[model samples]
Target: MTVTVQPSPRPRAARSSGIGRLLIAVYAVLALGAAGRSAVQIIERFDTAPLAFTLSAIAALVYFVATVALIAPGKAWSRVAWAAIGFEAVGVLIVGALSVAMPQLFPEATVWSFFGMGYLFIPLVLPWLGLWWLATVRRSERVAAAAEAA
Candidate 1:
């Protein structure tokens, strides 16, 4: 008699290809960076630019949520990713324009300032990629479901 061992399959969420892995890596890094920046700004010199610091904190929260949502499995998590990424895109555009058009209003740069120039515009482009990724995942999921049904 011989004993054979079978390896457990990867989780559905973790089964994503390289694109998914890359997205997770980028989002996680951005989340950590934004969180640290906001914490220091709010703690040491928030009084100097309360609005800017507050916006940084908000950006951090958005990034954090997006990161988790992208990694989680299920329809609910996908919706969360959509909402967070959509909000990020809108926030970056609005804040970027405001920062450029009325510099005095900011007094200090937030994460979305100058269209995320401080982060090399990754913040500007990331949401678009995230949205695309979510759509791709959803499409694939639908295809899988249809195949299973058939």
Candidate 2:
């Protein structure tokens, strides 16, 4: 006997999911921030805080990567986003800790500095939010898969 089955609807991702939009917005802000700050540091004051500026550049890079990963589709980039977001979470914690514990190490602030105090703690909070969003999406995918299988 043949089983009669309906096809599953395609997985959807819109250009304007509120959460995705917000993530994009945050990443855009960070990209500009990192781009602008890195430019200034490299141009005028690379000598004063090479380490902090480099970290800022790195933060910007991660944020940009995370932003693209969020907006784009597919399992590959989703995992990439997860990895980048996790790194962001770690970067914030590590930089926040060092900035506090070793004042001499960071004369000024990186984006991850002081738990992203300069960005009103958005940097501190955004990665965790990204991770949570990714988890939620994955769970939904699993539920959808199970339903389709049934």
Give the poorly placed runs of model 1, Cα more than 4 Å off: 1-16
Report lDDT (Cα) of residue 113, candidate 1: 95
Q: For model 1, what is the error of residue 141's alpha carbon versus the real structure, in angstroms, after optimal superposition?
A: 0.9
Window of ten residues with lowest summed lDDT in model 1: 7-16
Backbone clash pairs for candidate 2 read: none
**1-150 in candidate 2: lDDT tens per residue?**
999997866564442265878888988889889878977886888889989999999998998898888888888888888899999999999999999899788887899888999989999999888888888788777777777677
* TM-score, structure 1 vs. true: 0.88
